[model samples]
Target: LENTEFNLLSMMYDVANILAFKAEEKGLELSCFIDPYIDPFVIGDPLRIRQVLINLTNNSLKFTEKGEVSIRGTLKEDLGNRFSLWFSVRDTGIGIPEEKLDKIFESFSQADTSTTRRFGGTGLRLSISRTLVEMMGGSLSVSSVEGKWSEFKFFIYLEKQASDSVSRKDIDIDLSTKNILIVDDNKTNRDILRQQLLKWKCKVVEAESGKAALAKMREAVDSMSPFNLAIVDLQMPAMDGLDFGRLVKSDDDLKSTILVLLSSVTNKGEIDTSKNIGSSRYLSKPLKQSDLYNCLMAMFYRESKSEKILETVSEPTGIIDGVKILLTEDNLINQKVAVKILEKSHHKVACANNGEEAVKMLEADHYDLVLMDCQMPVMDGYEATKLIRSKPEISAIPIIALTASALKGDREKCIEAGMDDYLTKPLKREELNMMLSKWANKKHKQ
Candidate 1:
């Protein structure tokens, strides 16, 4: 097995990110949590681990019509240099029958023939996953109730790489002095947030609901200690994040407290609503530590009054609004999805069916950035980049490569082809936002 030292948290984020668009398209919530206490840098076969997770999560999404699919990793046992990690993919989907469960992991076998016809799979994923997990020193297991939910889990021992461990000092923003409030109806969500905040040395207080959070905030205020930040969940029962944010913003005393609203991927449109309600930032779940760190960095660090971090974090389009982007791809479906994601962030997007069209479009108009797909019918992204670089006028614009290939060295190939960066399909909106924020030239935005 390809054993290497990798950031466990980053690997989990990549899995969630790659599947995020799919989960959103299916109208499902995808949540990922890795135990905060565990040192995230570990020695293991990350690729195989990621593959198993993706397979299980994809199956969960395929079968689940409603509710959420959660991927969680807990520190089962701390064994000094090695740790026993319990990983699980849980979904509120149709589960296997008790008798059929034993055969589900058999090659070419499924819960039933109807399941094969309905879900449309070769039914080899679980079998292959079991093989991979066992190769990695773990045995895959499942628990399910036929009509309700299913959970696939395994325990694997990984060597903790303390030399590569992430600490509070690694974060760019200073959170030690910050007092934060986490509001979520789910205790697990709150606990995860609390643990993360505590790890960053932030003082955290949790509330079960928006109303309870308000009470806690009031108590903190009355005691001459007020929370500077509040993280609220969007889908709470009675009072949601938008309503809570509105109430806080309108209050004379609590108006200064920064509000960051967490929403499911499907509720991304509600970002606009959160902004309208005066929330400082909106993050789509499942949240990654890097994304949360970036959000906090934006909140805490601002250059000027005009460039308020709140607006930078909350605006409909992106950090730089009204950017003009040219999308180059041959596939109609990929082109459409990319366009929609770009436009949703308030950027103006133009599509080129092939690389030749992309070159022609660039010649005709100015664009802030170019999203170039590697393979196309008429021409390819590599040739298009070379041609663009040969020109003096439009040569400086950033060209981010989009590829479906996951083979090793693909990124290096893209960079060698003169691409600024690369992303694998399908794309996630949060990732696109981060990329745009990185490559979008300020002068190019309207």
Candidate 2:
């Protein structure tokens, strides 16, 4: 039941089922040993904790093909009035190299390119898990032996609760009238950023390319108003955050805007360059909500009394009006669900059940955007996209790949095949809208 105590066992069971399905598909075994006595209630976010467990279990399944993946959770200890809970997920998969074990927890850091080639992910799960665990006053750690297996363990301290009543409304932030700019080449990243910012009631603007971001700033200045902060991506075509920031700082009028550079690059030299441009903060890509929130809070608190009051941006629940979209999917259920979501956002949508249909439809009519399902009958997304790109007339049309696969090299493959962006399956409405809005804005500028 939704209102029942947030039991770790139930969450583990869910993870076990997911792993079991994955194992079954790959011909492996998945099991769990969860202690029934482990505190089923904690004054914390259960959904987030579940995400951590699922991520670990999913990782286990990804690496293991013939061996078993086992999960165990128990009461580590109770320290007087407070209690510590520990959970371990172990796998008889390819063990991580000892040298690379620590790096795996870093955002976008995988053991090797081959890992990405074989398994699809942004390599963001573990990093997100670490952040989530820490936010809940917990610690997550990992151990592995090369050519053997691996184990991931985490401990969280929780106060015993008498009732299963908790409300996230208490954590809601008030962000009204704050102007925030999100800059990322990836539409999904922009979407996630926009949705999270909007939740705080902030006014959100998006730029897909760094060149466009500079143009946006100029437009804002021309209108006699500028954004409060710019969340710029470090990697983009035409221009990057370092160069963009330098340009911003060089302009006397735009110098006042706070610059927050985002990147997946962990090289210290690159970070130093960003800092030299007078950026207020630097955030790594696959942004975390808590870290972003903290940075915003710190920025607001440090601002001068004469500065404008900041508003929190909230997630937009409905779709923007008048946008036309093409849905390229072979699966009827997927098409229905995706179209229903797009319709809720007020977008006029056209459907193509396969890549050939999508191509044929594109030839006859112009759709504002295309959501191409990667794997399809008749013509797969990659081939279809390449075909679209080869055409001189329709080459500029933005096409985003909707994929269920999260293996490494997937995003790169999509991009190489001519997709402008991508979203992993079980699509979130906010991410979809963000991608649409971002490309739509680009189309408007063109």
Candidate 3:
């Protein structure tokens, strides 16, 4: 029960989302997806797995200036209790030369010496990622073409968890006969979205670029079956989403078609501008089932709040949303779960593998709060809390105990050792939200 079946889907998407923002900065899109049938949970060091994804995703983004970087996760073998999962990261960027591909995984070596200058990396990230994958009894492999694309994948075995649940995706509007257009330069992105739409019985059409999308729409109009919705990437060659929207709105027949602008980055100004230019709504990537589903709902049926993406999901957003938090947890799975929840709400998280590491991080940087796991090898939370309390400057900072023991006096032990509050293991989002909201409000009052 203490850190077994970690969610690979959650880890992959989380890492992708974090890195997608970086890709977006350079006018590129980053996308991540799972097979949907793949077991959501797998046995592994969640943090290490996340680290592999982070390294690979960031590497792809770093090299890619245009087009997209994508991550895909699939189950190769479902062995009931254990499964073999294959994860891959692909990018439409400058790829490795045939000769250099063999050495990219070697320490201090990259595809080219000039790459080190053009793209900022130590060239050690891929080596470290490969090492981490191998440590989990997996092998990392790569295949790339020069000036085109690169894909890195690993096959890892993991035990399945008994107690796991996947979120349900419910569409409010009927997609049975709807005609949808998906426009993205990336084949992976376009294919994934097209497949999902097809499964829902929607008539799907795809275009690799904005010009092609416009031509498709014009053809559809001539055939008398105009697309009901268009999901256009914000960054595209020839014509961007904004320009496409302006052209679409200029035509009377096409103006009736709903437009949803998709971007890896959630820029308020861009979203507003898209709406002003005739886009029905804006959705941020990496796209999730919930995002796609809700986007469809808004575009077709929900007219009141169609323009704003989840404008009321949580108006009085948790104070932790944008706050800096230090997570002092030893268990990789637990750390992943907690960090995932915190990040979904937009909080910036820094992790400490153990109490000693947490102390070092705390001294080196500032965190608004601490989530301290009680059990650790190098330094336990109790002793770590005492040391942190001993420091005059940070003594006033809040420390919350995260413990697996629900036994009597556990709370008292945490309090006695200087933890300001207690949270049980497998923390619930509601409890965390309330705890953070309470502490954040208290801190604000102070």
Q: What residue pairs are clashing in model 3? A: none
Relative to the true structure, how large is the alpha-carbon lDDT of every model? 0.78, 0.71, 0.76
Better of 1 and 3 by lDDT: 1
Tens-place lDDT per residue, model 2, 57-122, is 777777876666777777889875557888888888888888898798997788878877886543
Candidate 2 ranges beyond 4 A from true positions: 1-5, 80-82, 114-122, 163-446
TM per prediction: 0.64, 0.39, 0.64
Superposed Cα deviation of residue 180, candidate 2 (Å) = 62
Better by lDDT, candidate 2 or 1: 1
Instruction: Give per-residue CA lDDT, model 1, range 268-368, as digits (tens).
Output: 88888888988889997878876787777668764464234223222124367788999998898998888888878788999998889998999999887
Task: Candidate 2: count the clashes.
Answer: 26
Residue runs of model 1 more than 4 Å from their true location after superposition: 162-177, 266-273, 297-446
Off by over 4 Å in 3: 5-7, 39-44, 65-67, 97-102, 110-114, 117-123, 159-174, 222-224, 301-446
lDDT tens string, model 3, 1-446? 11344455555665665565467567776788887566564566665566567667777877887888888888788787888889899899998899987888887786776887878654456777787787778999999999999999998888775643332212333488799999887787887888667656789999998899999999999999999999998877788888999999999978889999887654656877987898888888787755786678766777765534333221223464577889999888998999999999788899999989998898888787899999999999999986775454455467889999898667656754656677998899989988888555434322
